[model samples]
Target: MTGFRVLFRAACSRVEGTGHLRRCLTLARELVARGASVGVVTEDNPLARSLAFSSANLSVHFVAPGCLFADLIDDVAVVVIDMPKTDEQLSLHPDWIGQLRQADRAGVSVVSLGHVSASADCFRAVIDLYPSRTVHAVNYLEGPEYLILRPEFAASDIADGAFSDQCEANRVLVSMGGSDPQDLTGTAIKALIDTGVTMSVDLVIGSGYCGDLQAWQTQATAAGLELTVHRDLGANDMARLMRQSTLALVAFGTTAYELMALGRVAAAFTHYSWQEASAQRFESLGAIRYLGCAESVLSCRRIAEQVRQLLADRDAMAAMAKKGQALVDGRGACRVADLLQTYAQETRDRQLDLLYVVAHPGDELMGAGATLIRQIDEGLRVGLVVLGEGSASRWNEPGPSQDRELAQRGLKTALQQVADQLGLSAWYYYRFEDNRFDGHDRLDLVKVVESVIRRHCPHTVYTHHPADLNIDHRLCFEAVITATRPQPECPVTTVYSIETPSSTDWGSVLGHGVFQPNWFESVAATLERKLALLELYQSELRDDPHPRSLAAVADQARYWGRRIGVPCAEAFVLQRHLAATISEQKHSERQGES
Candidate 1:
């Protein structure tokens, strides 16, 4: 299946804080891993920009403050909105709900993260990891099972023995979300110092924090406290620091969930009234000690006393850790990914038009790359499939027993680049042996192609010509034909066989069936993209006279273009094509006869 293109819109800034941005990035990472192209559209806030840059393989777009949602909702299949919570209301601009309605009417799938005061009817799905009440909607995914923790936190080992020996567990961690706009780090540091327990402190401040760092360092030094200040820490580094600390003083947001994921007992404080629900919920469950709002006058002294008492009582600290771990297991991002994929599949079934299945990793680019690019540029959802591992090219090389592993790894990297360059909505790779398709049972290959057809439900299918010189290409064509045979359940309406630059043209003297192309697709605009993708598979390129050289590829495109009276073109043989009306008529006739 091809990946979906998603747009994530959130509010983030020094005042709004970075929780919304951070959580959105977490979800984006998971979606990207599942082969979705994720773009984050948010306010032009420094914190949001910094956090977006920190995430690899993500596209970030910044909008001016008060920009209409319609301005940022272009060319996306799905849109995720993450509104900041402050006071008692979600930080949604006046036009957000109206824009969401517009997006819904535009056929774009809309999802809302966390609770919002507006009616949920505008969204396709509503996700609140900690829903205060049962949402009676079928699209609502609530409870701790859907908690979206950073990947590092989800993978980290929980601190099951963090408080086993309170005397030795003297390290305290203090993090008040990303911005800490209220400058609560200083207060938390002061409360930690007032404990008078001679504990070391690890303080995390986000890049959005505009506090006086030097003054805080001076105060900690003068107070005879060992304090290490960290800024802009990555997810893994933060998880590592949390594991080394005995207690965490954090705000009631994503950070609190992270602490719970690591089973670190924390004294949670609310930076906003909207955060009080989560804080008090955790406290009531004995997972954390809620210390009211950080702005309260008695909060500093009360938090200090609570931390001191918890450190002194090993049993109490351990109990808290146990309860915290039980509350969150940290697999929410994957669950959310699954839901997004379902939505994407549904969208594609309604909107997609083409699927290209090739025999090997580079075959898609080598055979019909230009055509695929042109189709996608024309607003068609193009899916890709590579049936073989493409590892046989190195099978004869002299190397360690792990040569196969190395080849597979190299091919996987190249194919991923190809997928990204083509902007495919979905991609699938099978591990059938390269150049040795005959070695496997033919039924297996048929089943693989059939499954892909059923999943993607593409209207048009492209594969290699059956007469191609490559054995794998021949087998792939056969499999596609068998799998896509006319059936009431199969949505495939057409199948086109493309010519590989090397294989199709080289079989002329072998007396094999010729590739007689009757269909020519103009690819003048996307010929460069095809060439660029071919370059990514450098290992597969052959020298001059081999017909697979870069120069030969361009020459072939020119020859085909000249034949069709175009600047550049790709040739294809239309093996089968059925109009929807005719297919429905055939089905009706068969049912009547039965």
Candidate 2:
């Protein structure tokens, strides 16, 4: 166990189909670099066979479709499945997954790696592309490994002048898996010629011997494009190539994530699949240039032209490579490694306990929602209990007051705005008398929250800042104090609002007035989102019939922001450390956690 001997089982068949095995090979190399005895077991999909032979630290063990689980588990302290959730992911076949579980039960730690391993609970440790929500790890499972990108990507130390010679400068690799059992390589070569000029061209052919690799080699040579048919390069080499090359004409698959990790500027050309849907966002981020697939060689001319343009601009390509690297650090594999290491080192019986309560829509949105989204995105266990009816009974509009629906519409919109902007979980709202927080029974408020805490047992609770100017905000704060009072041992981290423009005096909100705030927190990263959320209070803006309030709130935050040297910031009055409540047990727990 000290010097772990790990076996990586992967799915590698086609050129495009090789990401799973490729990344697994990357991980194996990482372990080998770390001084572990590493080996690989693959379906022997032709794409993966080369990896077995490439690394000195890796010993190859080939298995056929019908290989039994016992045969797959030979000489392995831990079995790491390196199959991602691409359309070509093959390791999760029921038979293989079942075998891995059996191996785990037999005391061989099962570590599942790849984007595609969804049921994390089934393995001792499951590593993936990013933090996963679809698979619950910290709770039901032993460990959750985050996909670690390779170091070659993070270091960005591309061999100085990997393409120094102008004659060999325009090199690119437009390689995917070998599922095309259809001879797309010949068409791709034809398409490359159609696009423009380049002396050195890397023709990546992985495990898929769809047709004759020899024939494609012949065609590639005839085109005068130096075709390097690499059947045996590890993921580390592939990552190097993605970074060293001026540009890559690739598809929406594991290669994309790898290039994204390497921060290699790439132009995507896909036929169509689930991966394509996510590619739209990748394109928006300028990580990829999209070109739809070609049914035949006739349609690849356009694809070639696109690749041609990228080749012409090395500077632009370098910029994209940096951007891609920023988008994904090769930490995914390391993330998985750490998780597995921790689990292999420890065993525990843990309980998830919590006490969570929140004020209705506006309070949660304006301040708490941003932090909540950050927590949720990290795969934490959390929920909110909002206390307010969807009514604006306390609102004092200049014009004729409207019905409950009309008044609450703005609040609802703002709440929705917070959720959408922060990508937070669906909120749970209650119809309590709004603007009348002062009248809500302290005991009743506490009781409702206490009931929720007992039901969910949340480890942390977030609430409105206790000393805020808004009467409603104050009450929301008080209710949480009362709820957590009984369960003094439970921990609740409280977060308060930066006074909203709607809750302020018109004079101060105008920015020229004297009600300027002295307190602020850098909300620079979330400023646009905050701006957008403020719009949700359409009722507030429309209440005056002038829509001046909309601009007023922004002006106030901006004024404070300018004073603080930040682009934008939200103001807060934190009194959680008041002398009177200094030693209060409830206050003590909420003190440092928040």
Candidate 3:
């Protein structure tokens, strides 16, 4: 019974804000890609907005917020929260805190997720602005263990790299706050020039400031300090400017943290009271220099000197950069996901259930990658089922000779290397002769897989995914499906794809605008083992593309690492998660009984 990781629900506050939903989506994608199923539980109010903002691949369900204290879902591995809850008064309600505590007590790791104002007592951990020494002030739990800092921002690796022309401009971004009530951009701009910095500025005003900002932009040109203003910097532009900024001058809030993470140090000028407190806290950590309200700070000649001090000395700049990143790691989403996946594996003995059915040489290695690492590191029992001899194609070559057959025999040797790496049982390969297709219809092949399923009676079955574009991958999906449909102990998970088997020759496939989806999986846990298994696929991914090449598989996984926000990933599209009948019900119940 692999549990799911869920995020908390809430309304009011910044329910429509993309920041909260963005974090949830990142974490969900990471956890779900690993073995653990990841679900999100958010309130209806914010969910509508998030739906427009989120990617369809990530699943987030809207449940009422009132059920906070209820033992909602037992199979949940962790609960993450960052939304604004209005059903209960956060300032006065002990119940809100109690709800989080209840989740912690249930052995479900609780993470009070945040970017700003990130201090949590009830959570097992706080995923937020990281590496900041301010995290050291948390009163409970091991600060380091409970504090999951992200790497993208925590380190200064990208600061000295590059910047946009506009970024280097005295472009001062003024995102008033997540929810800017006062619409304070005009006055803030006035105060800045009043300070006599007279630097050219690109103001990032929000969606709500259309008219006022337009008028100010016109005036900005006339005022003559070489000012150009932009309101609501479109997504791409905002990121570009942030990457290439001399400094970001925003009011104290999450943007401050994000800018800091981007290695752009910002000066804070608080408009509201809580902002003042946050500015103070950030200042204590050397994250930013606060200069009273926007109006007053904008009027002083001393502002230029302060800006020069921050800009001239790279040492102080780097230190401040690190301090800001200390608040949270950009990798928070991925790591939290891995943690929950490990939690799901903890139930293995209690549920001697799922058997990951593999095909060919690198099937298991490429598909169930993250799970393989956890299984081997913990010395867990894993059942292996290799479908064929995994031999290379002899379809077009000279009549199959003894030499070619020995290479065919190489499939078993390669598979053994895989098993040895995983510390798992030997391959129960049906030895139906590898890669050389025994002429058969999709249905007949299904029967053979069906026989395997009946004999194993595994609670969960992992196989090739149906929608896979490769020939054998397609065949595996159809066969696995036919074999598992009628029995009680049939494989619960019908399929997963091994991308290597579906390789495209670079010569035939280049210069085409075709989109390839590579599975993003971390084989690090069993990376050595995975490569060993690939050694078994004697005909896999050859560079010359003589019909077998696994290079595409590994290359694609590395490519995916750069996408979906990770370093390395082996991906598999999920096929099923349901109990279709009484037998399916009993199978699940039986898994629990074990």
Candidate 4:
């Protein structure tokens, strides 16, 4: 309940295969490590049960084959579907689509895996782990960068001197995934025997496999080979076998990716046409030798010949091993987990109506904290960005006593607590020197602001007025203006300038510019929360009568609200506003051109 609840719906069966389940398990393991509660929904097969039993944190939901999942979509943060069987099946599955639609309507995010040919509009995002040339929809995350691999496979080190020509080659690994409906394992074993090589064979058979295990053992013994058959091998055991073996003959799927991660030279074949693309991609990358479909007799002979040649030619095997290792660094699961985390964060951020760009850590709370809390109460996402370190006052004190670094660290911690109290969807800080904006290059400041704006892509932006007494406040206003300028692709449709308690009021006496308010947001319900959050910045708070004093801040909110006939409110100067339609049209035109 503390973390995200992710439900994985995979296409798995004894007759179909377990590749989808295996990949889902890899991602599930990563998610669990990141404090997620994972549930897997698949057919009640031996492999599915085995996977569920292996992970203490995983909950298994057994669905009958060709039947819809039961009512379990509520309360899930994310629903990840890994149905690599077929696009038609994914699209036409009534229960699958209904669950996804229900989750989508309930504000839960949905992600699809290996959805190459399906319509991507049903889900929030689609992930294609293999190298693909097809142009997908905007929500698709394609290419090898998104490949998901188990932690053991990802953490295993590449074999030392594995590519050396003088390295001894003795053992070969033959694994064709959890349920080889076409009996590719039997074919691979026979092909290895036909090679007539004097090497030990490590055959890994899945629990769900319905092949004749006794016949395979007899054939291996008659061919004068030392065969070791492993059943239901776990991830750690598989990694150990892959490391110990000199070469692998695997069906093109998750197993091939595992072998590649371990830097094992492999000749990959496909049992299904859907796997050809992945096999050819690995072959082109020199990571594996593609032996075509395993069902073809000629392809089986080719697999045998390739095994013979690779064993005899140490340099070729080493080159292949090195290439395979180089292609898959084993950190792909981490990358994918990061994306999922970001997507979850962005799901919340998408509801934000405003992003406050401030010059110091406590500026937002001191300026428009009540307004932010009010917006959140009204179900709007609110974000914060503090551009300066806010420690210049401590650093510039007359006494050389305080540790400036320590003071800054404490200020940052206080800012984080304040942000949390305000329920900010996203918060960022740039530790630039406080009150020293004049000393830094303006272009650098602009670029920094631009990056944050691009990331949050908020519909509305709030910053300081340009005519502020504080140099950092004035510069931050200028940078925000430049960063959120009306561009064809920019998401900012409206920008407002708010008054910081110390900076905005002090500038009135200088006659530089008056702090005039054109907008007032009632914060009567949240003024107490705002004041409470402001108290966290003890280093920045002042005694009564000072402009930044707690009492004065409360009085100012009442004063602004009284002018607008409200109990309490925050004031803002409307700087720029654009129609949402105009921005959307420009964005669409730009996308079309691209």
Judged by TM-score, which candidate is best?
Answer: 4
Candidate 2 lDDT, tens digit per residue, 1-594?
356567777766653365566577777777776676777777755555655566555677777754533354565567776654521344435565667556655556666553432433335444434222232111111111133555665534444322233323677776755454445555667677777585566766655546677876676677777877675455567765765566666655556666666556667655434444456545655556766544323467777777777777766666665555555555666655544444443212112232224545655544433444445556664455566743556556644322332345446545545544554322344445666666655765655565444434554555655444456656766776776553455444442334544443433433433334445666556555655665665544443333235455456557667889987666654423223355686784887499
Residue 253 lDDT in model 4? 74
Model 4 alpha-carbon drift over 4 Å, by segment: 155-161, 164-167, 295-298, 352-594
Error of 2 at 587 (Å): 34
CA lDDT scores, all candidates in order? 0.76, 0.54, 0.51, 0.75
Cα lDDT tens digits for candidate 3, 230-282? 55454457656666666767765556666665666777766544336556756
Clashes of each: 6, 35, 34, 1
Candidate 4 — which pairs collide?
352-381
User: Which tens-of-lDDT digit does each residue in 1-594 have in candidate 1?
Assistant: 245688888778888888887788888888877778888888886677777778757888888877645355666778887875411233355556667767666667777777643444456666776555333211344556578998777734553534455336589888987788878888888788788888888889888788887888898889888989888788879988888888888887788888778777888777776667767766776778887775556566777898899888878888888777776778878877776775666564434578888988888888688888888888898888787867765678655433443455567668867776677876766656678889878987787677556555788999999888888888899999999999999888899999887788876665768999999988888888788889889888999877889888888888899998998888999999986688888996898599
Off by over 4 Å in 3: 1-3, 10-18, 43-52, 62-74, 83-107, 114-123, 126-159, 162-169, 182-184, 206-211, 225-236, 269-285, 292-329, 339-594
A best-first ranking of the candidates according to their lDDT comes to 1, 4, 2, 3
Can you give the TM-score per candidate against the true fold? 0.57, 0.50, 0.46, 0.60
C-alpha RMSD of candidate 1: 16.7
lDDT of 2 at 57: 59
Candidate 3 local Cα displacement, residue 522, angstroms: 38
